[model samples]
Target: MSLLSKIAEIEAEMARTQKNKATNYHLGLLKAKLAKLKQQLISGSSGKGGGGGTDGFDVTKTGDARVGLVGFPSVGKSTLLNKLTGTYSEVAAYEFTTLTCVPGVFKYKGAKIQLLDLPGIIEGAKDGKGRGRQVIGVARTCSLILIVLDVMKPLTHKRIIEKEVEGFGIRLNKKPPNITITKKDKGGIIITTTQPLKKIDDETIKSICHEYRISNAQIQIRCQATADDLIDVIEGNRVYVPCIYVLNKIDQITIEELDILSKCPHYVPISAHHEWNLDGLIEKIWQYLDLVRIYTKPKGQIPDYNAPVILKSAETRVEHFCLRIHKTLLAQFKHALVWGKSVKHNPQKVGKEHVLQDEDVVQIIKR
Candidate 1:
């Protein structure tokens, strides 16, 4: 489902739940946000929840944005989710270990982005890699897909996974996936019989960046960078997808790997087992994604001056947001008074069909 539609769904649900929870402060705030969301939906601006024109790629009604993690088994995709969200997904060192999508929430920048661990996608998985056909289901629901690579095989591994998603009809622009290096603290750690780390050239990292459409805007190519600026640059480039890098097994890699690691963007040298970069990973993740929230209040007399504001991703009529507060309030709905924002749309008394905007605190004077 589109993100905006999901947000609309949330609004409707919140409105229904408001009846018994009228005094709940959070519910009131959620209702105010729902008011904004309903307006967004009515105006057909539910494309990408980003606050802008009607020209969004694809926005669902709900703030529930899905970031799907897909890769062949043993690439440590599940382990990434576990480290990031504390999800208890089974991680085995074998082929096709994950057979379905395991969903968990990962917050970036005060926004909740749903993370899904899809089964090990194979070459023909798009055509239903054994039972991997559910990718279509996952794609249909998720807002973005994070293509995880073990960094061992480098580009070769990512290429295969890309093909599967395309075949399954998951159309995405060069949307940059949070392309994680996974086991950072494992410098001396052992997982498989992979070769010892070796120095990878600019062209190689660039190739991976190109595959993910990440732009290398800064950094000196010839000289070496032991500092963390290069890493921040890469993490900053992640406006749309997974925004950080988890440098798996840093303690185990050769000097060549360490040299490369220092320059990578948002690289957190951590081992999931050893729990090294876990906090940094979380902080980076929160810093990288976009989230839209709406703050709302019930259809009561007035709201507190400092009540929490709900954020809605779409354009919803104020009345619609009110409906979220009470189906009956929408029925006995009168005009609304908006208290926030620069623009003034004085409560031009109407029915329970008013639309709202960001920071527009409301007082839904009902019948």
Candidate 2:
């Protein structure tokens, strides 16, 4: 049987199998096998003559961060791109209007954000349908994903798009599982957990590991983990990213319906055509991106407030800030005087390792 056929057979079996303590091991093994098959399919397709070349989808990474607009065709992705960035992406009332990746840039909160309007993806995108691989490949590189959906059928489209991205190893709005697997030469599978295992057991874990040909390894479960989590760790190629569901065409929906959608988490309802609630969308994007703005203060001079240095929240250390300014700045750096929420006192002397906070004023004092 073909790889696709084999994958389908395994999926069918997994669906038919009941979930219980007795079937958990079987299910775990099946999941491992399924993940392996999917990996093979991805590798094979990306190889020579596999037709997985991302020719036009390779957009240059510019700006402070990148966000991708992904959804079914004619779902207002192009319209959103145009409205937000003033970049033409061939807005149309038809599906697949934007055939390739179209990139645009917009500035928000002193940060230059690059937004990409990707081609509309169809079902079975992970299996290489409708140039889906190339579209999703670009998505994997995004810092955040804006899933543009038609407000009328938002949930239906959301689920399909989520599945398509998930199938391609993109875990939207989720953190990586707290499971660690270390390979060894000889000692058999050793399982350790800091918390109780509610969703997965030792036998199931062993079965999953064995399926991946991992005979000797140390597995540490830090939280309540499941078979899927174990499988994700074994696969080891997952991308965890935040996603905002841009429910477009909200002008067609009633106020009551819009209110209901507003209650949903990570959802921003807007009318791309009429340009409604776009400010809320931009705010949510800034929030999800978790960026920190550090104002530079020269010695005996006022801090540069107009052009703040933008850094990701996770990389807001004094060293990172210096590196952002210039690579050689770190070599001449002595210490930083930080005046913000990150420091206990205003203008506290801090080392390069000190982490910075948003809206912080940093004055570098070199030796």
Candidate 3:
């Protein structure tokens, strides 16, 4: 059967479990996961060659913007989710506390984004330990992944975390994941960052080098003042959606560690339970989500902001929306009345060739 069908099967089982008194975290995770799977299938990525893109799943079609929190257990993925969405995920001082996926929604300037806190994964997570296939599947389904790291001493966990993330990326269609260095407490000088240096041991580095050959993309970054999210955003990488990195538990990081973190790009320091700079995090994420509020009205009616208006990308056109509404609209489409300055849709009678702009209301007249 097609991958879509397979995803449907899983979704059906999940629905049953959810109705049969399943846990909210698990139900939420399964539902969100099914949504992602359906999206990939709709975009034609369900082909046999597995997912095809470095940015998690390869969606050749219009896909939702999904942000996932990824890290080993106790690194604060759940805590961050709790703080960001008020989900009240069980937080503890140990590993493997989060056994299931937790999904929550966050709003930034009227745009709602899906935030996922996946179960904690460890070394060889993709190989079978700790439900590796499931966890890897969760991360693989995301459009973007937020890697969290503890900015503490020893540097062993840091290296392990980075290595594991990169390694897992390699295993899943050679996708390149965004990194987030999370710091807990304060003590050391400052962390330093340099362009991501390939550790030779990291297969992602080798795979990326082999794939791109000459193109250069840095990997590592130290937390800094200007850093509020992932390196792709901090370094001005042309990204489809914006990403933010939270260095949780800033109270645990030392000044010396801060010096090291400052080497790459500066990230935001936050305490998940204390509401420290949480709004800043929300604003930054909202800005990157590319959310637009569009108003809609039928015929000669006043634009109703409360109406269910379709939200799409800034560049999405009327024809694109037409297909979404109905495939036959593309063929039977006549002229449409446009409000606001959509450039393509604003003027007199426009055909399917019209492109839509943010907040532009439209009325289509077809035979």
Q: Supply the global lDDT for candidate 3.
A: 0.54
Question: Taking the tens digit of each residue's C-alpha lDDT, what string does model 2 give over 61-128?
Answer: 99999999999998999989999999998977888888889999999978899999999999998987
TM-score of 3: 0.55
Candidate 2: clashing pairs of residues: none
Give candidates' CA RMSD values in order.
Answer: 22.8, 1.5, 17.9
How many clashes does the backbone of model 1 have?
Answer: 72
Error of 1 at 227 (Å): 44
Summarize candidate 1's per-residue lDDT along 1-367 as a digit string, tens digits: 7635656576577667744322343443443344344333333422234633222123243434566776667767788888777787788878877765676776554456677777776675543335445554455466555555555554576567655554333444434332233333323212221232123334434443333344533323332321122232333322223323345544466778767765765444555556666676555544443332335445654555443333343435665566555667766655666655523555444344445554566666656
Candidate 3's error at 330, in angstroms? Answer: 4.1
- Candidate 3, residues 1-367, lDDT tens digits: the string is 8654666587577667734222433443444444344444334422234532223222222224567777777878888898777776788998888766677777554455677777776876433345444555556556556666554532465455444443333221122244433333443222335444322223332232233231334434433312112322322322232334556666677778755654544255566656666786666555555555555556767777664344556546777767656788778877777777675434457666777667777777777
Question: Candidate 2: TM-score?
Answer: 0.97
Q: Which model scores highest in TM-score?
A: 2
Residue 272, model 3, lDDT: 69
C-alpha lDDT score of every prediction, in listed order: 0.50, 0.91, 0.54
Which candidate do you rate higher for lDDT, 1 or 3?
A: 3
Worst 10 residues of 1 by lDDT: 188-197
Q: lDDT score, residue 242, model 1?
A: 38
